[model samples]
Target chain A: MIDSINPTAKTVGMLIGSIALGFTFHWQLNVLLSLVCLLFLMTSKRAKLSTMVRVLIPIAFISVSYFMTGWLFSSEQALFSLTNETIVAGGRAELINGLNLGTRILAFGMIGISYSLTTDSYDLIVSFIQQAKMPMKVGYAILTAFNLTSLIQTEYEHSKLAIQVRNLPVKGFDTKPLFTMMVRMVRWSERLSLSMEAKGFSEERTMHRQLKIKRRDIAFAAGFPLVILGLGMILAR
Target chain B: MNKKELTLRDYLLMALISVVFGVFYLLAVYAGTALTTVLTPFGLGVLGYEPFYGIWFMAAIITTYLIRKPVVGIVTEMIAALIEVLLGNMFGVIILISAFIQGLGVEVAFAFTGYKKYTYKVTMTSAVTATVLTFIWTGFRNNYLAMDWRIVLAIFVTRLLSSLFFTGYLSKLICDKLDEAGILNSMQTREVHDR
Candidate 1:
């Protein structure tokens, strides 16, 4: 169901939702938002549980680190006191703040994963051109690059292999292979543009996939943030 | 056709290079996350990602150095961030905003030189500008302002060095190497002649 939404609309909705999430520093709200995002990801057909887990492992570490650092260096530490009772209270407050910082990372990771796992790269570009008003030329250029990614990967491996075979002195910061790669890519770009021109490619061309903005898109765009921020307001108290 | 305008080849090269750097950006994030976890006990987790921030800006720097055109840094950075999003970057759409702002920093530095000079000083200037601008943005987004002053300073210093090393010095080295090897001769010659 999430994948069915236009990628542009989904992106806008999530972008606003993520921005809203950023301003919020409440742990409860962050946890709630993360859980909601996790639920979306879990239900989405495109998000494999294994991939999600693999991605979340590092995010989990970062989140924990944030929590620890947030506790120790919290700005609220300026409220220092000598009294034992006040010390304990301050410590607890710092802990809560730390949790807030930590959970914020989780929330963001979940939100990002929810969007990225479900969205298709090609569809996203198409939506960018069709809905976001991106120039067709830019869109096509990006698509062309997208197709070259695999070739680029192979080229990178070949460069590395060539370095080993040639026994080049370049070790850590070798620019030789990078230069080679860039030279080849430059030639490829020149040829690609020429061939595209020869094939009569133009900005006036039509797209095979037409992404439409439905009522659901509007609802997701507006409602996602409204729900998250509204809950944040209620939970902050 | 304006002589200074970017052609299809320029756009394609920018896109392709951005794609490569986008992958590097992902690797840098992993390294950063690991570093962050290691430093978490010292209450300086934010500093972990500082070292890798330069890698994020490399696409912009390298593209601009090679292209020697106005605003190529900004456009290349934006495209790199777009590719990152497409590649499932964990930071998601907010990175797009960060990219645009950081690109502006690189652009401002080059703008001061009237977009003519691609010297080492100019490249380092852009790196410093990008580091400071992006740090300010990150501080706001990550609540770094609320952290202890020492931690903030550390983050800034580490980030500046990282930016200088990777975006400034390293990119300059690579571009110069390409030029020395005659690899950039055709592209540079065409652009110089066109100008």
Candidate 2:
């Protein structure tokens, strides 16, 4: 269900909705939204338990750190003094603010993870090209580059190994190899473009794959923000 | 200088460069996250993360330099942000906004140069412009105004220096090395021949 929705809509909707929700500073509302997002993730077929765990671990760490920071460093007045003299300001407002910030971060992460796990990168690019009217040449080039990531990673590893084998002076922060790799990749892109041109790739080309927005996609695209906004309003009150 | 449409080669180069710097950006995010966690207790939470802010703009600056195009910086940064989101960045959808602003900052800087100059001085000026623009945007967005003035100042200064170093000095250095390797000249030659 999540995968079938237009990526551009999902991305734009989630971005706009989340940014709107983030500024609300209502901890309860944010928490409810985050839980709803988590429920969505849990129900999605693409979101595995392991993936959830991997994503949440960082969110948990960040939330904890945010809470700690807000508690300790917030300039708000102290609601109550702690027993420890070093512990200066322990305020209810500050604690709530921390929770709000942390949970908001988690909510944002959850929304992102849902989009990423469900949406294919190619589909996203295609949606950009088709729906958002991005230039086809630029879209295809981005697709090519995206596909080349693993290959580039492999080459980077190989270069590192080669440097090790040759016993080169592996100084701290050595960027020479990086620059060389970049230049090489640029050259490869040049060649690739030449080959593509030879094959008659041009501005006006037909796409074989068709992207249609189904009824379910419309429901999802419209329903998500409305539901979140409703819940936010209710909870804020 | 005659304006030319970007070729497939230019787009691909932008992508390639974005991918390379995207990795650096991912690492910087990790480092910034860790430092923010470690430093938050000392009231230096936001300031601690300032240094990593400029690394985000490196791809945009470097790509603009290499491509010497008007919107390449914005496009490259957007692509990089997409990749980051795809890679499961915790900031998620908001990364797009950050990337857009950062890219626009560099794009505006280049625009000030009439998209003609790619000098070290121009690069530095662009970096500073981008840094200041982003700083202001983030400050307003994240409610940094509520924070103590000292922390805000520290963040601003550190972010400026970091942007200057990574996007300005470091990107220029890499482009110079690429030029020295004759790869840039070859690409230029191919572009001329194709034209």
Candidate 3:
């Protein structure tokens, strides 16, 4: 169901919702928002459990960091003392602030994962070209580059092997191989552009893959943000 | 037609480079998360995470340097942000707004040079401008105003220095290497002749 929705609408909705959620400082509201986002992800048959787990790992780390740091550094006045003496400074207020930021981050992550896991790359590019009115020249270039992912991976492995054979020190963050790979990729991209021109690719031509906004797309585009807003308001009180 | 306008080749090159840097950005995000986590207990989380902030702007600077077209920095960074979103970035769609702001900042720096200089000095200037703009924007967006001024200042300084190193110095080094390897001669020569 999610896969059938228009990628552009889903992305725009997510962008609006996430930005709105980012500004709020209420932990309870953000937590509720995150739980709703998670529930949506869980219900989406297209959203893989493994992908959700992968996305959640980083959010988990981020949330912990936000909670700890916000509690320590937030300027909010202490709501209570940590010990018999006010040794630690920030108290309940800081904790709430921290949790708010942490859960907001989690909510953002879940929304991103849901969209990416379900949306096809070709559909996304098409939607941008058709719905967003991105320049065809720019859109096609991105599509070409996106299609080169496997080739890039192969080149990376080859470069790594070549480095080993050349006895280059495989030390920390060696950028030589990366730069060499980039140079090669740059050359390839130039060739790709030339070949595309040779094949008569033009901006004036319309894309064959037509992007259509279905009923589900409209429903998701309008419904998701409203749900988030409603949940945030209800939970804030 | 303006000869300096970006051609199809320029777009392809920018997109390819942005795709490569998109991978690097993802790795940096993970490293940044870990570093932030480790430093949070010490109350230096913001400062500790500052160094990775500049990495995000590298693609824009490098793309601008390579293409030398007006607004290529912004376009390249936007494409990179798009690729990141497609890769399921933890920050999601917010990356798009951040990228646009950072790209605009770089574009401003290049414009200050009259779009003529691709020197180390200009690169550093662009990095500084981008970092400062992004810092201010994020400060407001992330509620950094609620933090103590001392911590905010610390983060600002650290972020500035990191941008200098990553986007300015390191990018220049890479460009120099590409130049030495003769990979950039065609573009530079064309640019010089155009000028």
Candidate 4:
């Protein structure tokens, strides 16, 4: 409820953080961004270590798969052969490979965790639209999406239990039933959207936020480019 | 049969399942190489299910299973795959192609059944569909033929089982659970196999 207030700082922080770490895949850059995320997690009273851990588990898998796939796919120069004729795959360590995809994911996850921790979804969207010049339509759409994340979680749990209690052998997926469910869900969202429209709840939101681009906001936004530049230089050297 | 419209609750359930499964997928990958590949095949075997081919099997069947709308599953899966691509992976363009082809495969399963029924058989059918489409992708990527055909066949079978067990059955279980909990509207429940 209180999330209806200021959420600009955290959103801004997330933006700054992701841009710094999202794309380029250098171990040094990843280490740096990860450390920054760690720093925020450690210092931000709002941040929860458990939630961060939850997000990290997937990131870890994704990155490893990236690496493992590289290993399996390698037909390049051999580093050193074992007693067997199997030679080392030299092309595996390209830092920017998919395995190191943790950068954007880390950025997104950190941003998500940081946002959830620091501010409620309400404030986050409002601040984005009103303060940051993010279009009100996009802001509200995202806000609504975020707001319902928990609801989605609950409903899923509910359906699972119902299936179990029915004494049905609800174990494997059939293309038939799964599709049936998705169609149902989309319909509901549409109805809800329709209801919102009927109530004159339009995407025509005109709430202009009043956050000034403070010195800190400017500095924060500028920081990522400079860091990327510095890292770029370091890598070149 | 007509495609049913789901409530927010339905989407949330699917999203939650995706999230948890994603976490589990990560664990599987970690288990694969982090002393896991050495253990059971299940631990890190998912590592083989990279952003490319595996997603097709996953998204096709998954989206198909959850939405029941023929192309929706494929399309949503494609969107999800695009999201992954935006995040970047080893096979960039390949991911998009797999999504399209895989979506086509899932769509085919629905088509074969005439979209007339939703049952475990169809799920398995689509699971196989996903496997076959993915086989083509693997063949294209040279992942299939490069390894021994026997080993490749073994991988395909393992993926088939995983799809059946995890992607196929689990999706239905989770959906049914959500449906009964009153979280899913009675209407949504009515669209599929009624309990």
Candidate 5:
């Protein structure tokens, strides 16, 4: 179900859910969304277990860090004082605030994982160009650069080898190789663009893959957030 | 210098710049996350990412200064975010929002300089603008308002310094190197010859 939905729709739906998640600090909502996103990913089986575990480990640490920060430095002491709440209640509010911060990270991380793990890069760009009205030039440039990533890595390695061959001190953060690669990049970009123009690449061309908005897209886009909102309201105490 | 139009070459250059920095941003994110874990017990985890905040804006600064065009900062930032998403960033869609806001801030700062001054001061100003805008956004998204003012102040200050060094000073240094290598000149010459 997750994989078959349009990439753009998944992106739009997740983005809406995230923005809505930003406006409040309700721990319940955060936890619910996080759990739902995790379940969604698990059921899809698109993400490998090892990858999920690796990503979640860092996320869990970061979320715990956020929890500690929120607990230690909450600015709501005035509210606790003015309301005349008991110390225990005040402590509970701080705990809730911290939990909210912690779980918010989990929710966001899960949402991001779901979108990235399931969506293909080429498909996403196609969706952007065809369904989202992105300019052809921008879309193609991105696609080209995306293709160049591996080449870029290879070039960097070659530069590093060249430096080692020259018997120069190779630091981890040396900029010489980076600058050399960048010069090559300038040349490559120019040649690529020229070749593209020579091949009569223009905006008035047909796409081989025409990504369209389907019923599933609409259902996911609208229903994802609505379900979250509806659940939040139902769970509101 | 009627070279205001963004040609395909310019877009491709922006794409390349974003791709390079996108990789760097991921490294920074990992480093920062590790640091955050180490510092969580001290309630200073928010400060962990501050040191890398400058790297986040490097693409925007370099693109604007090198391209010297309107909206290059914002566009490059957006492209960087897109690439990161494609590279499987765990922050997800919120990063897109940060990209827009940070890019807008960089654009506004350079716009203040009329896009003509590529000085250290100008880059620093651009970095500052981006830092403040993104900090405010983070404040809301990360619930900084709920944190103590002292911690908030500390995070802001560290971020400001990081931006000044990494985004402003380092990007200017890189651009200077590029200029010295005559790479930028080649770009301009090609554009002029094409016309």
Candidate 6:
């Protein structure tokens, strides 16, 4: 059932991207890896500009945060001080620091996107618990955690619409409507849980559908380390 | 073995609350970037994230304050946060680590109450709890909070106000609203309603 998406794409993208991230901080290396992954987006049978936007948007924050934290300090060692109000030191050191920090985060987001792009949601969970050695029981417990990214949006929208229909003053930080939604969601979880058990969930341990570690998995895992070593070498030189 | 086992219904409620808290947090997080830029000068900057995000603390308070238990808040909030991580927050492992610390702050309120009960005092306690614990952690993590005492004090005061106003007050307001709707009639809401 989970094979509905580019099941291999996420697996490969994440595997390669994660290795690239782990192996090197060399600007060229990371940039190459990012561009390669971006090419997958370009050539992707399914990847879109919207996905690019969604993925990179989170990166912007991480990048900006790195700059703010790395450059802005109370020290006289200021980088190119912008009238930016925040204490950002302006210079080569500061610039390098920003790039270093920003690339690291950009890699993180890129890896995340690549993973999401290639992997099915269900398989991702399965691999984490089964292969990664996380407790399966807790994994299943986390399965209940799925509603956050999915149907809850509909529920929140419905609640907001309900308020609009009632002509409630749902604006300007009153938080009454927000509060109303919180209680209702808490109330709904109970009902959803009952449905799970009534539908035959149990403590029985049965063999689960497991994913096989392919040659590719090994390649990515092994390659990631080598890349990191190369970056360290570059930095040292 | 005759444990008064929590029913599936109770378990579901826990998950639901976790989900609810998750939604609340997502709102706060998104609202932070959009709102902080505008409110920076007015000192409403504390309402934003970045310098300090208090969602973990707020989530802990909501779940614990309602469940009226000690570890429930900490455990629930942590799990909810892990869900946020799983949902692919870019903060990565750092957020996962922060969640537990933040939850511990709210858990202190429950601890101070001797793990005995929940009340408006406990609510305020947990609010104070979130305030103290989170303020301390953010000082170093955000670096901004770690500045001089004036800045530290300002950050602390800003966080405390956010906790009371957004976390405690908002949580209580939700509890009251749900009661009026009769959905939470099973909880203390009904008891208050009948009176």
TM-score of B-chain for each predicted structure, in order: 0.91, 0.92, 0.90, 0.69, 0.95, 0.72
Candidate 5 regions exceeding 4 Å error are A77-90, A232-237, B1-3
* Candidate 6 to truth, TM: 0.67
TM-score result, candidate 5:
0.93
What are the candidates' individual DockQ scores?
Answer: 0.59, 0.50, 0.53, 0.08, 0.67, 0.22
Residue pairs with clashing backbones, model 1 = none
lDDT by residue (B76-195, candidate 2, tens digit) is: 888787777666566677778888888988888688878888889888987888888888777655555334456567778999999899888888888787778787688778778987
In candidate 5, what are the lDDT values of residues A1-237, reduced to their tens digit? 588788888889988878777775567888878888887778775777887787788888888988888877777752363235334554676776677788887888888888877788899999998888888888899989888888777777798899989998766556677677777777888898999999998888678887888998999999888877776666553
User: Tens digits of per-residue lDDT for model 6 on A104-191?
Assistant: 5566565555544544446655776556654444455566656454676677667777888988756634456557666676666555
Docking quality class, candidate 3: medium
Docking class of 6: incorrect
What TM-score is obtained by chain A of candidate 4? Answer: 0.61
* Per-candidate TM-score against the hidden true structure: 0.92, 0.89, 0.88, 0.49, 0.93, 0.67
lDDT by residue (B1-195, candidate 3, tens digit) is 123767787888888888777666766776777788778788666665687878888888877877776888889988887776666666666778888999998888788777788898898998889988898778755667556567778888888998898888888888788878887787666556646
The native-contact fraction of candidate 3 is 0.54
Model 6 reproduces a share of the real contacts of 0.15
lDDT of 1 by residue, B99-169 (tens): 89888988787788777788899889988999889988887677674566787888899989999998889
Model 3: residues >4 Å from true position, as ranges?
A77-90, A214-219, A226-237, B1-3, B46-48, B188-195
Model 6 misplaced stretches (Cα beyond 4 Å): A1-49, A65-119, A128-150, A172-174, A205-208, A212-237, B1-11, B21-23, B35-52, B68-70, B85-88, B92-94, B128-157, B176-195
Quick one: ranking by lDDT, best first? 5, 1, 3, 2, 6, 4
> What would the DockQ be for model 2?
0.50
Name the better of 1 and 3 by TM-score: 1
Model 2: lDDT equals: 0.73
**Per-residue C-alpha lDDT of model 5 across residues B1-195, encoded as one tens digit per residue:** 234678888888889878876657767887898889789999888788898899888888877766788899999988888887877777867788889999998888788767878899888888889889999999878878767789899999999999999888988898899999887787778877978
